[model samples]
Target: MSTGQVLDQVMDIDEVDLTVDTEVDVNCISKHRSKVHQHFTKIENKFQCNHCKKTFNIEKYGCTSNRLKHLNSKHPSKVEKDQTHALTQKNVILQAFQKQQKNQSEADLQRLITRFIILTDQPFVITEAQSFFELMAFGKTNAPAIPSADTIRRKIFAVYDEEKLKISQKLQSAPGKISLGADCWTAATGKSFHGILASWIDADWNFQQVGLDFDILNGNHKGKSLAASMFKVMNEYGIASKLMAITTDNASNTDTMFLELQKILSEN
Candidate 1:
């Protein structure tokens, strides 16, 4: 018999043979069509050729490889612009972060200044305040920007003067005979100096310093001049006769001055 006739006869004898043939044909068609669709889809998604402005299939050439070829051939300016844009974005982000950090630092400095004023009860000049903020912001060991020493000196002097006034008022009200102490020394600047200190016995009977003064002697250490300055200080404080006794560190010049001071007081 002929092969076609024999196959038909076999199919007619068993329907299962016909069903197997149909299944095989369907699977074969699906595989063939699937490969074609994949190839065309890749081609459709590919970038246009930079030199020719032509569309090409990436199935034959990979996307990255094709882009590299285009850059080397014709799109150098486009690549440069992309790189520049990325760098610019990065720089912008960095600058913004720095500005945010700077603002936070300023806020911290202001808070610290406020706390210092409250704790110390002292007012700071603008330059001193700036220096203090810099120290706190950077570190205690960090070198500060140069500031005018005169300005800092003025602020310190003002605070000291105010404190001195308060202390003097307290001393005026304190009861008891205050002792007077005097001394002389040469300053580092080669100037002769005389210092007078007032001390009082408190309720507990311990001597406490109540007032002090330093006089620049212009290189003179004479007993008379030192005694005159001491008397002036005592008279100003209305305590010339109120001193119970005077103390010194065994200097001959101070002993002579004390003897002169006693004679002056006796005559007065």
Candidate 2:
């Protein structure tokens, strides 16, 4: 500021006596210059209200509580608007969380439906049970929607495929060769069947065994068809080359099938 501006703003200048015996004190001029410097160097503490777009500072008449009191008294509409906006944002977050929970419940229920279908080996189109499940879940918060029979069936098949892949991976990673035991038999209904089992000693030297397949012998259980079915399971498990031995009953067809399988294995 110019000298006149500083002189006009400094209250001490008005209190000075312009007597004939004394001039302006040099210390007073220095003090006024310090005041100007302090004015420029001062750190302002101010906050702006979001909703009202108004600024307030707490430097003069107490702390920030006065600014807050003034804001509430003068701009209540702006405070209400901010409160409403905050409530809206909270509701949005709540809705997103609820939606996520609903989706998770739906996924779990679909897996449960698949288990129900496969473990029971029941037809999917049991309308009575379907309606019962729907009624049970009705008006329940975050409950899964009851799907149609076809949808449940599809989920069951998908679960089957995923489990098959896991088991195949285990077979491929088995430490030693797997032994095979096959049997052909006539069921009570006179339907022909052939069953295959895989056995092996695991890394811990524990004996492990599982049924590989149980196929209906609609056609003749000749060497070619028997070999085809067995090999299909082996190849699917990626363990065809690790076959240690095959055992079956002393039937003529069984011997033929073994001979054919031997030739196929040797050739490959």
Summarize candidate 2's per-residue lDDT along 47-94 as a digit string, tens digits.
Answer: 455445455532441233444465568766655665686566555555
Per-candidate TM equals 0.44, 0.55
Over the stretch 1-268, how does candidate 1's per-residue lDDT look in tens digits? 4434433433322121112223233322222211122222223434365345655544333334445455645766656765676566555555554444544553354444444554676554543666655755552332333334354455456655776677566556557877888888887788888888888876677768854678787547878878877887777667775678888787678877887888787787
Predicted structure with the largest TM-score when compared to the true one: 2
| lDDT: worst 10-residue window of model 1 | 31-40
Stretches of model 2 off by over 4 angstroms after superposition:
1-104, 127-135, 138-142, 188-191
Worst 10 residues of 2 by lDDT: 33-42
lDDT (Cα, 0-100) at 243 in candidate 1: 77
Q: Quote the positional error of residue 22 for candidate 1 in Å.
A: 50
